[model samples]
Target: MRWARAIHHLEALAQECAVMATRPASIFPVRVVELWAVGDVLGPLRDIDAVTVALAVDLPVEEVPWLGQPRGAQQWANATRLDRNPIVGLWRSVHAPVWNHRVERPALVWDAENGVAEKTLAALHDGAGERVRLPAPGAEEWRARLTEELAVSVRALRDCTAAYEQRRWSPGKLEPVADALWRASEGYLDVLDALHGPPEPT
Candidate 1:
């Protein structure tokens, strides 16, 4: 898959973030976990976006063998289960205001994130594919890399959204791509706020 490398990179980042969550002095433990969750969600999302782009450009659909299969449901289920994880639940309970402040439209964003994954996986049943083990970076390096990669993923999803819009695809087809873009953009914003702290109050 063209996005294989990016997906792997995200996984590596997520792993590092998980370790960061364990640090005694980490002030952004919840945010770190959120980043990890976002990375998990993005794996399948990137695959969906890639296939959507391929289809838009008139590429052979056969290259993706998982489309129109049931396996995607399982993949989506597995990826999203983390949202209900106890740690994430605790974050929601304890840090609701902080998260809301950092991410505008938190409910809508979360819905879009899950909705896109469900719809895309239902239609295009490809799992996250093979794992590419990457070495987790140190704190400073991982933070820098996460910012860079989040930007790249957001830009790619934006391009994918444009491809669908340009072709005048149906809402059914276009909605998922747009939702994916929205989710990715929110994830980027969340990360930025986590890294540098949220913007000062007006």
Candidate 2:
């Protein structure tokens, strides 16, 4: 009942803020359709806890003008953390990445169905709450796409490792390098799998 109530509350907030823009841009860079709570609300009771809400927004919060804060240092600082009232909780929930000196927002699959899939994936992976589940769209398609990319990356990493090992004919040096590469590649592949689901067998 708490989970349902929480969802209902978030849904109402999303609707109210859906059309409200924060000066230069909207608080939700993406047109929010889903509000993903970061943790399982139904978990074992604790004295106190914090709830984080990740939104399925149209754009990344970092790029939004009010969020980007190009004018001054104070503004930029505020933008980075998204310390504004009303939706600060949602802003902090979403992950923002930086590249080429610019904060990059999520380039989400914008399709309505994929939006649900994205939220479902996040809940499964982040919350680890199997009871909270939603059917993912294009499961087969995602599997296939990720599979091809995985194969290519794996092959390339293998070749690179082989070449690096060959460069130094000493087993003592080669063994450690090979081992490190193996572990690194495995971890990298696992991350990719987690993001898009495992690649299906050919």
Candidate 3:
């Protein structure tokens, strides 16, 4: 629950910082990826009690202080603490193919790419940590994975909505609904619409 809380906070901060980024050099570029992104799309997650979000950026560590209050607060927290620098360590961890493409706005792209990658990565690893080849994103296996993910999101939304209608609202319980709405905007809607049309008037 702490992890989810932390992620929710970070997401809020990110949205705020992104707004400020309209001014030139107001906020530096920050790439938020991995578990936190996945969590945003399908979370208030289970298992994995201890978790930390990942960020990527190129800047001198000393220049971080110039980033003023709340603009780079999370980054400051991560970099200042000796033990909280996972992103820094990741730079040295191992190599993965770097994606090469024109990003329209590098600072403001959050999409279902993270969700798609999460499914792909899960398919690529067995419970025992053995390697497996993942199905291509448009392939049958990958479609199946996305379908299942959508179903989970839909079910979660329905449950939360029903509970809210019954006046049973609770903090954090509706997070899945939020995730569903967000992921839908992030491209899950197109995927589902292509595969099965709009959800039958739930």
Candidate number with greatest lDDT:
2
Write model 2 residue lDDT over 24-86, tens digit each, in one string: 343323333334444343233332133334443444332221112211323422543323322
Instruction: List candidate 1 segments past 4 Å from native.
Output: 1-138, 167-173
Candidate 3 per-residue C-alpha lDDT over 17-51 given as tens digits, one digit per residue, 9 for 90 to 100: 34433433434334322222222222323433432
| TM-score to native of every candidate shown | 0.31, 0.29, 0.26
Steric clash count of candidate 3: 0
Q: Residue 12 CA error for candidate 1 (Å)?
A: 23
Candidate 3's error at 170, in angstroms? 11
Q: What TM-score would you give candidate 3 relative to the actual structure?
A: 0.26
Model 3 misplaced regions, further than 4 Å: 1-135, 168-191, 198-202
Top TM-score prediction, candidate number: 1
lDDT of 2 at 167: 58
Over 1-202, each residue of candidate 1 has an lDDT whose tens digit, in order, gives: 4455434433443344344435543332122223312223323435322111100111122211111111122232234343322222112221212122222212111121222223322222233322321234467765665465445445644664676577565544666555545655565566567667889999
List pairs with backbone clashes in candidate 3.
none
CA shift of 116, model 1, Å: 30
lDDT, model 3: 0.33
